[model samples]
Target: MKIGLYFGTFNPIHVGHLTLANHIAEHSNLDQVWFVVTPQSPFKKKSSLLDNHQRLEMVYRATKDYDKLRPSDIEFGLNQPNYTIDTLTYLHEKFPNHEFALIMGEDNLKSFHKWKNYEIILENHYIYVYPRLTKVKTASQFKDHPKIFNISAPIMGLSSTFIRQEIKAGKNIRPMLPEHVWEYLDEMNFYK
Candidate 1:
């Protein structure tokens, strides 16, 4: 099986994330797109992130209806601050029969060199890069890499930070997230 690992903090699984994952699953030739909920990101701030369990639950609730796109807590058992290479390595060991591809945004590809063993990641795993609203594109050096794929997916400008701010201000952002997730956020009064 070919699986695309769409890893993230998923502080809250918003519509943009779901849209991107669905696009990848439908167009990227992968059998599944797993939203690997990171417990901690080496590159992001942890202070404002929701607890991993809550974030994972939100991912599950938001993606329960989708068969190909779903949430994964694979990184929850791994050591923090989680790095992509390490997680991919562990996954390879556990699922030796499956071929795993790393799914990321073009904004991330711009900083790909900063990651640990980036060359190894490029050499071993296939990369599916979805476009983000950022000006950043894939770096020139990696443009011709065979393992990398630049997918033309629907652009979702909505962001989790913006959604959180809207919720904090008592604005309506239900349309920007899954219906169930909005209810979960409301029931928990999260981000208030």
Candidate 2:
């Protein structure tokens, strides 16, 4: 099976995430899109993230209804400050028969060259890039790369940061998250 790895911290899984992942899965050749929940992103501050298990649970709830979308805790067991290349390598070895590809935003592609062993990643696997609202331009090298595919998916303006801030401010963010995820957050009183 061809799996697109959508990596994120997912402090709280939201509808925007689900919509984008589902769009990619339905439109692309990939059979499944796994929401790889990162325990700690190298570029993000760990202190701002929710507990790994809690965030994973929210992802599970958000993706449970979608056949093509699934939640993954693969990165939780990996070393701290883990790089995408390392995760890709481990996943390849673990699931030898399944092909893995990357699911990223156009904004992320702008900084792709800085990622560890990015050249190796491009050589070994295909990348599915979705449109994102960003002022930065993508690197010229990636524009015509054979391994990179530009998917005309919807540009999601919603972000987890905005959701968290709203929740903390006592605003109803019910529309931003899945029904189950909203209930989980309310019951736990998270980000308040």
Candidate 3:
């Protein structure tokens, strides 16, 4: 079985996230797209991050109905300052039978080399990159790259940070997140 690993903080799982995962699963060769919830992203700010488990739960709630989309808390047990290469190694060891692929936007592709053991990640796993408004120059930067895919899913250009900001401002996030997830966010008063 082939699985596309879509890693993110998912501060609050939204429609854009669901759409991308659905798009990848439907359009790609992979059988499923796992949402690998990151406890902390090295490149991102830690001050504004909510509890990792809560974020993971929202992801679970958002993707519960979709069998093709799964919420994976694999990074929760791993070391802090989680790196993609480390997670990939651990998953490969644990699930040897399943073929794992890396899923990300073109934005991440441009900054791929900064990651630890980046060379190993490129060599070991297939990378499926989705296009964003900012077309990153990944092809020129990384030679002999892994399986790069450009999916035609709808792009909302929305970020978890933006969603959180909207909540903090007492603005409605109904348009930002899925119906169920937004309901939970309202009930919990997250990002307040």
Candidate 4:
């Protein structure tokens, strides 16, 4: 199976994440899209960030109904401050038969060159780039690279930070999250 890894902290999984993952899974040749829940870096603690399992639970609730989407906590067991290269290598070894690709935003593509072992990553796996509201230009090398595919998914301006802020301000951000995820957050009193 071909799986596209969509990495995020997902402090609280929301609609924007679901929509983007679903769109890519349905529109692209990828067989499935994995919402790879990134674990918090041990070096930089943020008060607002939920525990890794809590965030993973939110992701599970958000994606439970989608056949093509699934939640992944692969990074939780890895070393802290893990890089993409490490995770990719680990997954490749674990699932040798499956072809893995990366799902990223246009904004990340702009700074792709700075990532550790970026050349090795490009040589081994494909990258699926979705549109983002960024003015920065992508690196010229990636503009027409064979390993990189530009997916014309809709640009979602919504963000987890904005949702958290709205919740903290006592605003009903129900529309911004999945029904189950909203209930989970409400029950846990997260970001409030």
Best by lDDT: 4
The candidates, ranked best first by TM-score, are: 4, 2, 1, 3
Assess every candidate by TM-score: 0.94, 0.95, 0.91, 0.98
- Off-target runs (Cα >4 Å) in candidate 3 are 41-46, 139-146
**Candidate 1's residue-wise lDDT over 31-114, tens digit each?**
999999878655676676888899999999999999998789999898877788999999999999999999988888888989
The positional error of residue 81 in candidate 4, measured at the CA in angstroms, is: 1.3
Give Cα-based local distance difference scores for all models: 0.89, 0.93, 0.84, 0.94
lDDT of 4 by residue, 17-57 (tens): 99999999999999999999999888996779999999999
lDDT tens readout by residue for model 2, 52-117:
899999999999989999999998888878899999999989999999999999889999999999
Candidate 2 weakest ten by summed lDDT: 40-49
Worst 10 residues of 1 by lDDT: 40-49
Error of 3 at 148 (Å): 2.2
Please provide, for model 3 over 149-176, each residue's C-alpha lDDT reduced to its tens digit, 9 standing for 90 to 100. Answer: 5667777688888888888998877987
Model 4: lDDT to the true structure: 0.94
The number of the candidate with the highest TM-score is 4
Clashing pairs in 3: none
